[model samples]
Target: MMKRIALLWNVVKGDARVLWHALRQPERPVWLVPATALVALYALDPFNIAMPLAGVVDDGIIVPLLLHVMVRCLPAHMRRA
Candidate 1:
């Protein structure tokens, strides 16, 4: 029973390490972009602002623009051939 638990723990740790390494690689810039956007949004505090422009800029413009860019940037293999 103890050996089985140790094996399972090691397997989980190995998988986490693999994911960490993948996120660190240069080819995965998309992962970093979303995180930066989130940080910017938080710093801006769009919700508390009294103006409609803030909501429009954050939710209406930036969010959809980011989604559009992400959709276009998806790998060719992900799209129907």
Candidate 2:
């Protein structure tokens, strides 16, 4: 129904606002994380480095590990928010 759609829209909007606020926190150093992660990921990529397990190592482990490091690099306060 229209009412259900409206409620869903409201919930999604609120969640977005919360995420926007979190991303804007002064102490977060937001851009630094992804930029560094990208560089690190590229350097450590198996194929780029001529490793034999290029696909599996890069996709299965390195990518996720880089993402986790990126998230961890964000300020604690921003993450808590």
Candidate 3:
């Protein structure tokens, strides 16, 4: 469990760094901001799609998957090791 937590923390930190860099750049990809906003909105569950019991499961799986995809969609230059 600790290992998983540490890994998650590392990934979050790395993604945050990449996003900060992307935000500071003049030529950031057009999709970056909208995609990030979508992920944030989905995470907030404002639409209440997770009303059903199964919906919670969907949120658990989908949110992180969306985040992973969003980070992956960043330009190679924006991504770091």
List the candidates ranked by lDDT, beginning with the highest.
Answer: 3, 2, 1
Q: Which one is best on lDDT?
A: 3
TM-score of each model, in listed order: 0.35, 0.40, 0.68
Cα RMSD, model 3: 3.1
Task: Find the 10 residues in a row with the least total lDDT in model 3.
Answer: 46-55
TM-score of 1: 0.35
Q: Which residue pairs come into collision in candidate 1?
A: none
Q: Compute the lDDT for candidate 1.
A: 0.51
Q: Which candidate would rank higher by TM-score, 1 or 2?
A: 2
Where in model 2 is the C-alpha error above 4 Å?
A: 1-53
- Model 2: weakest 10-residue lDDT segment is 11-20
lDDT of 3 by residue, 1-81 (tens): 789868866876677677768867888999888887877777777455537566666665676667667779888877763
Better candidate number, 2 or 3, judged by TM-score: 3
